[model samples]
Target: MLFALGFYTLQALHYYSPYFSIFAVIAYGLGISVSADFVCERLKSTRASFMGRNLLTAIGAVAAIVVMVFTIKDTPPTASNANLAGLAQYMRTSTDVPGDFYDYAKKPSYSVMCSWADACKLQYLSQRAMVSSANQEIGIKGIIASERFYQATSEDEALAMLRSLDVKYVVAGGRLTVWHGDISKIGISGANPDKTVRVLKGDELPANKVGQLMAARMVWSSARLASSGVTSPLHHFRLLYISYYDSEKPPLLLYEIVKGARVVVKAKPNSPVAISTNISFNTRRFTAWHDSGTTNEHGVFSTIVPSSSSLVFQLNR
Candidate 1:
């Protein structure tokens, strides 16, 4: 009983020392054995008492076996540990991370921008820094900064935000598209095609082009984009792009800007394609693109090669 009481006290105190629990269980079993022996000696003269005690003990043994069986049957496998191991392997093998980015002790020097859960696991398993984790220990400013970085109107803005946070690598996986409830309240709507609106505070959004230009300068001067080189059955690479927003519905007009490169656009089959370009234009200008043609059954379309221009695409209703 004392051992049991101590075990409960330790649990209440949140001291989950496994060795201490084992010792307590052993002491408890000894105490029960001694007590049972004393009781049996006193009741030795009574056959009825002995029979009752033996019957109760047998029932308790059977009940314990039943409970143990049920517990063993219902318990799920430890799949999360396996997943973490796999992630660690992936991070180690990834070519996207530069050699200098492997330094573990330096905070904010090299960190991954990803979902809270992935950030935590990657940080632990990879022994690298992460921008955010399951806990919001980075605080409101960090959260706001991350939001601005993802929803930036241009590459320059996004790069500037990454520089501010000292984030070296951007990781994208299944978690990137997964909808996290209430994330919209924090100005981070997930990659769901239906949820297109992105909100930002005045301070969070860049006030002028000067700051954006500075950010772009920093990116060109310091950082270099690379691929993770991780391949899976579903996709060729685990890390897609450095940007945070979805590829299908790019958040900004800057994303559509391609220089001497083929641009691919996907939409619902047979949807009309509207393409346009203007140097001094924002995302709003894309809405005015002239209708080109209806997409085929594959929902894919190619753009005419352009040298330097601000391009936009919209599906006609």
Candidate 2:
């Protein structure tokens, strides 16, 4: 009765879809119900009916599977590098893709992506909740096929999938970062020592690799001025590098922030260097935060924010 349940759910929400989710739910429910009928028939000495029920269940299961597979496979490609900047901004405020997307922050509850009848139970949860997925496969498995998650045979395919899904953020290692050139690693981990590119979501891809290299080179030049990882205990002078996929200009000199405990920085005498803070945070909902600005010639800035989890930026004196 999954179909009926979904229909009732949609009705409760005042949804107007043709009840596709309801139908699927019903089909699957029928499969199970028919199997139960078969068992009951066997108990009542109804041999012919048991066979028919078994066949019905089998058919229903196959139909459900086929419909779900087709629906997932036929989803349209969603990426367009052409207004990439604007789309990235929009996605920054969004938590998940359109199909699996949900928001219970309002009344008259509504269905988001995938199922179109009722709000997902997940919508009621707060954004601070975190779901850890150790690997791509696990993460993909957690999401419906129509969602942003997918299994690709190759890195190119995976990148293509991200583009198709208009994925705004990606978490990967240095090797994949170098390969895709679109995504960057964020924060620091013992597993990721180089601390190359961390968060790659920005307005536009640099015009060319030279621009990217320039950005990397600039970061390397100013590494001594960047901030340390949010988790770092013993702070020291750190150089930061943020990488990206579309190579057009330098990846970006996000800003040089200080790292060591109780450390302070001011631009050296006669140095006209400018700097700004790059703020970021992580919870279950939003992936990363990036806001870049410049500092006065003296290059002085500080904040008393929490050191344990807060990502900070301070330029070296």
In order, what lDDT does every prediction score? 0.40, 0.32
RMSD of 1: 15.7
- Give lDDT: candidate 2, residue 196: 42
- lDDT per residue for candidate 1 within 1-317, as digits (tens), equals 65445434433222223355444444444444455555766876576457545764555445434433433332222225444444444454542453344444444335555545456665655555566665423434434344344434455455556666656555433323323332332234334445554443553433333223222212211111111111101111111122223434322111111233234668888777654432222222211112155678988776543323335533333
Q: In terms of lDDT, which candidate is strongest? A: 1
User: RMSD of each candidate?
Assistant: 15.7, 17.0
Query: Per-residue lDDT for 58 in model 2?
Result: 76
TM agreement with the true structure for every prediction: 0.32, 0.25
- Estimate the overall C-alpha local distance difference test score of candidate 2: 0.32
Q: Runs in model 2 with CA error above 4 Å?
A: 1-19, 43-226, 229-268, 271-278, 284-317
